[model samples]
Target chain A: DAGITQSPRHKVTETGTPVTLRCHQTENHRYMYWYRQDPGHGLRLIHYSYGVKDTDKGEVSDGYSVSRSKTEDFLLTLESATSSQTSVYFCAIRGLGEAFFGQGTRLTVV
Target chain B: QQPVQSPQAVILREGEDAVINCSSSKALYSVHWYRQKHGEAPVFLMILLKGGEQKGHEKISASFNEKKQQSSLYLTASQLSYSGTYFCGTEVQGNTPLVFGKGTRLSVIA
Candidate 1:
């Protein structure tokens, strides 16, 4: 198994609230990615970080933001949560050959 | 862009074999494979780089075709432990986040 962990394994927030999910890794990998998995859409990228303080937006970046202040930590935030944002969020770390994912956080915005 | 996977669902008996295919319209530099059990994290499977490379872990194997912009995952002599959802992720440019397909659900029964 990979040395990656995700905080708030499960969460429930009301609409218009703020929520933050954290991903921590002990492998010191250079690339980190945040993705959301829904019923029909599968998994879509939200944001990714290649290095400390260096991040990029993915296809579904709207309504989501990320920060990587350190190599081992990557954070995803929903500034103002909405029902549409309710989904399972996953974090992945990449290496030379393949990438490993965290356990995932199940978020439901009611 | 997201990759498209074939056979939304599949059922197999122990000691059987299965194949999952992924196709993308965007130019692909690499292809990755992952498997996620129900309500669990997706474990890293393999990555096929450009120039028709192949790589895998365990009993799984994969191949990439840069010209066709496609990839296929082959599972030989599948076991009941192989029951899960298979996902194919494509890395377009180097350092770019991987875009995943909808995924194929495979159930290996006894």
Candidate 2:
């Protein structure tokens, strides 16, 4: 209910192909984060943006990239998809004292 | 580093109580709790900031111990709706992305 949405709720891409997932928010929050959830890894941060054009890498930044050109949009791209990259990706906005997440994008690499 | 969660899975009967613990090796500035049902995105439960801080939502509550760099979530009189994977995320400072634990799967049966 934080006005966050992730495009392409589900996707299947070929290995070595490029894929980009979009996260759009209407709350105008300054902090936006991208996380991937796997069976045993839970949610691992992929990348995050603090403001427009300001982004930083997380622990699991390999094979992935992110950009935020506007306050309302954050994008995560997989340069070359791999089977290991298959997971549920969630976009979150930190507001007030809590974090709200988007519905999540389930991506599978074949 | 990712936080460690105890009791990878738990099974509780309706009206029973449960506690899930999350510990981190590094110091923590805050701890956040979230729950995700099967095939759904996680939803924020509550956040605990300061040492000894405790917060509650309905029958679910959590405590943060800064000295130990850990947090614990408690659920009293659990319901079937409480069946989900519980995750605890740790933040080292403000505006930083959270690092989540592996998650504790909880199942409540009638």
Candidate 3:
């Protein structure tokens, strides 16, 4: 129900190709996060941004990069797609006490 | 680190009760609960801060134990709508991103 949106809700890319997923929010939240969900792995943090141009790596930041040039937009990019990187990616923005998530983007790399 | 959730999966009849527990090895600043259907974004359920508080939403309730670095979620008189995967996320401090547990899949049968 939050004002969060993810672009390219579903995507399929060939291996070694670069892919980027976009997360946009209208809540003006200061904290934005990118997470990936696999079948057995509930959710793993990929990267997060606290403010414009301020970003940090998470537990599974390998092969991924993030940029937050504006407060409402956060981008997650896979330098080179791989089958192992196929997963559902979610974007979340921290609100009063809880975080609001987007509809999620399902990406497939073959 | 990710929290450890008990009972990887659960099955309950309509109007029955069930409980899901989440434990962490590191200290917790807060515990967050979320639920996701088969293929959708996770929906925020509740958040328990460091004060070791208990909160409820409808028939769903959760308790946080700061001392034990754990949290528990209780679903009373469960309904079919409750059939989903429940995840517990732990935050080490304010403004910090969460580390989520391997979710518990709940199936409610009529």
TM-score values for chain B across all models:
0.96, 0.98, 0.98
lDDT, residue B96, candidate 2: 78
DockQ values per model: 0.83, 0.89, 0.89
- Stretches > 4 Å off in candidate 1: none
Query: Tens digit of lDDT per residue, candidate 3, span A33-108?
Result: 9999998898999999989999999999999999999999999999999999989999999965898889999999
lDDT of residue A64 for candidate 2: 97
TM for candidate 1 is: 0.95
Better model by TM-score: candidate 1 vs candidate 2: 2
Best by lDDT: 3
Q: Residues B1-110, candidate 2, lDDT per residue (tens digit)?
A: 99999889999999999999999999888999999999888999998996789999999999999899989999999999999999998989875788999999999998
- In model 3, pairs of residues that clash are none
lDDT of every predicted structure (CA atoms): 0.91, 0.94, 0.95
Candidate number with the higher TM-score (1 or 3):
3
Query: Candidate 2: misplaced stretches above 4 Å?
Result: none
